[model samples]
Target: MASASLKAPPLPFLRAIAWLRDGMYALHRRMVPGHIALLELATAGYLSQATCAAAELGIADALAEGPRQPADLAAAVGANEDALRRLMRLLISAGVFAQRRDGAYELTGMSQALCSDAPVTLRDLLLFFGADLHRKHWTHLSGSVRSGGSLWPELEGMEFFEFADKHPEAGEIFDRAMTSVSSLSNEPLQAAFDFGRFGSIVDVGGGRGSLLVDILQRHPSMRGTVFDLPRVREGLEEELRMPGLTGRLTFEPGSFFDSVPKGADAYLLKHILHDWSDEDAERILRTIRAAMESEARLLIIEMVMPQHHRPHPGKIIDLEMLIQTPGGRERTQTEFGNLLSRSGFVLTGVTATAAPDCVIEAHPAW
Candidate 1:
């Protein structure tokens, strides 16, 4: 509140200027995300509920062949035609689906990715992330904001992994979601870095061998192994039987907190460290240090926080991790370098990938 003595008197023209200024500010306030988010929050419930129905009824997968009218899609998925049409109308207006003038509803690119039958779909992510309890858990995000602790146990009375272990269906969905996330990461990361130099590579905490298989395919001469919990080996073995990579890959079941199998010329960890705190990351790095051969190099494929953030998505993801897990977020190069140094590794170099991620490499410290 400016005092009357401090406030400048306005000319008639200046009053118009003030009016314009306030009007523009009011417009901005109305258009900004928070205003949009209030709308989005209302719509999010519809989207999540619709997604659950789609996953349950396999609507997305069935629609992949082409556009279909509501009655046809409903018949294929064993859903009610009028109810399906109503839901599709909402999704169409939201840009998740498209409608022809002929009254046929079609899947858009975004909706296509939500289909499980698609070659590289994130259907699993869409389904699991939109599951009722997951959304409910996020609704209590303020609890996480105030306490800076894990929300899974608070939400479900079980730790995240513990709940997943008990619910096999949810566990399968969790694993599938991780594997499918590589759908977005694959082309950008695989094309950006060259694997010709490393004869053997180890994927730390590689889930289900999806990424390992892709990497091995790109470099046929290179041998690869995926290390994850014992439960992951079945999927890895199934991946081994895939046409091109059977003989060149293996699966190792072990905890990264313990010693990793260390003879590979290169160790790859994608999206791993961000899930843990600095102390935990260092503990894992120390295990890698003890087991890795003297010549082995380490690669961390992750999002690096930019200096002087204007607005980076990784910052949001960092906050999300802070709420959902023990860790805070992606780090700047300096932050990662500091961790490497403290964990007996030397930062060799960093390479930015074509995607919004980068590869930070290191080796055993002298």
Candidate 2:
């Protein structure tokens, strides 16, 4: 479990950092020749691939003991010594790894996070993003843009979720990636919001019940349910076996498009709505609305895009949604309010967490 203090910095502090970072980038652009700056931007994909390669070869894990010569690292991770050395040099330049004067490579702060045993590992998340499936989908970004829709279903002849369902290996990587990503936000989310108010909560579309587990761990007396597809229930028995969650946590496999469990104090939807378009998202909201009592709250956990759009990670994730899902998108506060209104609910409040996600609370209109 992640520490409670892993929350995001204050918004004002973050804004200052972003301004400084952007200023530095602007300074670099001004200092460099036009073509040099353009070339740097163009070659960013190579860096991404290099990082992915390092991760796949377990280079960080290999260096976990201490700095090792390229020959030793190559042998440990089964790579060509010369090629591995070149890769390490590039990563070192990018501040991922460091090359000591002794001619050995070691993990940098960035690379340390890539190690499997790190306090918070992004190794799985990197693998998932760098996977061929995601790479192939990104290649169709232009087509999606032109069509004003997702190219995934058209290209693959199936929806993204369906493809994941059909391919177990791919599904496992995706699930692990989501869980890994969730770890970054879970602690911050708990710290920002008050889940203790809800004695009974249902995590709608909750895969593997990780969020619910986190919540249950905090609120001991709070009973929780993980409502997702039947396939999601596969390894949930293991989740149920966790120390404090034995009786308080339960798995209820079902589709949010159809219905959610009824009469819970709150319905949680973390990272769920962003994977769907307005129509489908509305259907999901309406389904939950039908299941909820008048007092029940709908807690939507997602990246609420900035209306003005200065610089937010959600902006980048929106592109991923565009190329991958059929009409899925990150919504703005106004857009969310409208969506909730259409789904027979009123937007109550929006609470920003330490993570990029915001808790958009809504209640049934009537």
Candidate 3:
């Protein structure tokens, strides 16, 4: 079976492609009638909703075996035949699925990613994005923008983590979505950094230990621990059972705000600091710093937002943090350096990974 992996070109080549893609977009905007282009932009939300609907209805899964007539697909997924046909037609226009002359629909490359068994399935991520709670959060985007804060606390009467704790189903979907995202970054991380240098590593706030498992599997001699909340331990049994990890990988249950596991050769914080404000991020960092030996390294994996106005995924994700989490935002390299200094660590080096995230290395300053 195929596994999710990153096969990106070198960074310079990728940047060149990005520049070309941006130029094409600009040229299209100039060539198309202004009103028509603006209309398409305005209607973009419709496409998002339609794609979410397709994922929710399992349209891609039903067609996984082969092409199927619209009526047959509707029956398989328990949807209205005419409505399913219309939805499939919209998706076809968007290049998600295709229809044959015989009136049967088949998966396009885009739709195939929605299949549960795909090499890099995005179905869980789509479902989480389209979940009712997420939609509600986005509806309050204006409030967050105006206040320069998240609306999650105001709407849910608690912080995002607490809300997740109380709602098991929502939490499960979020965890699954995060794991899917981790899969996308796994190979890129292995290629970008030297995890083998550390004899032992601890993944702070590492839900279910997905990244750590991938790393330990790559470096057979390296030992790894996943430190997360007690609830996250529920999923550890399955990962622990993965072949060749019987003794090399383990999970430790706790909160980073309190403390992290001590004295590992390296401490990895992947996508963890982005969930907090500078002050709170420092608290978590200080806690980790206190637990670390002077020689130990700290590895923070996150998107380093570009200082300029170039297009980056982190720019959009920063908005998501604004609406979803209190005092959370993606940081620039300088911002990261300042934050590490404040937390008693010196920014050492940064390695750009093939994925959107970059590996930032730091050491205790004092």
Candidate 4:
């Protein structure tokens, strides 16, 4: 009887309990930033998937003109309205889009970045990595760690480059991604290192020749060459026609594993050495060493792995290399110095760039 008259435990008591629980959660979130940050990191894959979907459907491009209802977006992209709305809801929560009071969705600054026509487009990277061939590699990341190498070749029955070569479309996507990413770093690299002293510079394994073009543009008196695979040369027509690059920049098609163009005062290997194991990296350096004169300099532009345990982009990219290439890993400064010594070169200096990469200057020891 007394228990039956409890009166739902008093509504205010229940409300207080709810408030206390919420306060505890808020306090935890405020106090333990790392805990909340890790929670966000755990969901990073899902966020990438959402971004991939948005990029594939050209959602940002569709909304570029203005805001649109979920129904309209679905119709424009040929998707189911409800499903699109749900996806947009997730993206909106991720700060990619904003929902109007009327239920229409509009692009945010971040979302605008996904547009294909954006000045610096990451659309190709998103689309490339989101594709089945590339995305599936991440599934075996743990196995790659256990095996001390990449599991991508094992899963695909072919190396990544082989697969890319076999699939021209995939190769195109890869090249476009490389071009887009390289474009972002080129300006920073140009600003970071002075190219004035070198009479001639060769961009080894330079994709699309963007870096060299940017370099030669800044140092008009300097001659430059883009040395890469034959396929890379084929893609450089437009780049060759650019105002400053027309007659100054030349193309040399070949493999760096075999040889590089000779007689350049400086040989620039931007983001190249990290793609190989120590043995392979040494071999590439030796080959370059043979091609270079005693006074010639090797400018190796790459992410120098930091010594401290802090949030560094190189650390994450190193993991990606581990998952993608069997022997690829970012090197520390000491590691670079030792590698150079083994390859008949001396690491003269390492200069930080405006970007995440560093310019590691080495000269032939012999």
Candidate No. with top TM-score: 3
Poorest 10 consecutive residues of model 2 by lDDT?
A: 1-10
Error of 4 at 119 (Å): 2.7
Clashes of 1: 0
- Error of model 1, residue 359, in angstroms: 1.4
Model 4 residue 115 lDDT score:
81
Model 4, runs deviating above 4 Å: 1-39, 100-104
lDDT of 3: 0.89
lDDT of 3 by residue, 83-173 (tens): 9888888899999999999999999989998998887788988898888889888889899989999877678899888888899988899
Candidate order (TM-score): 3, 2, 4, 1
Question: What does candidate 4's lDDT look like per residue over 218-262, in tens digits?
Answer: 687888989987877668887777776677888988888899888
Which candidate wins on lDDT?
Answer: 3
Pairs that clash in candidate 3: none
Worst 10 residues of 3 by lDDT: 1-10
Q: How does each model score on lDDT?
A: 0.77, 0.87, 0.89, 0.82
How many steric clashes between backbone atoms does each model show? Answer: 0, 0, 0, 0
Residue ranges of candidate 1 with Cα displaced over 4 Å:
1-56, 308-311
Model 2, span 70-172: residue lDDT tens: 7888999999998888888889999999999899998888998788877667888899888888999898888988998888767889989888889889888
Q: How does candidate 4 score on lDDT?
A: 0.82
Candidates in order: C-alpha RMSD to true structure: 11.8, 1.8, 1.6, 13.5
lDDT of 1 by residue, 22-77 (tens): 67766775788786857866776777677666666777788789889878888998
User: Which of candidates 3 and 4 is the stronger one according to lDDT?
Assistant: 3
- lDDT-wise, the better of 1 and 3 is 3
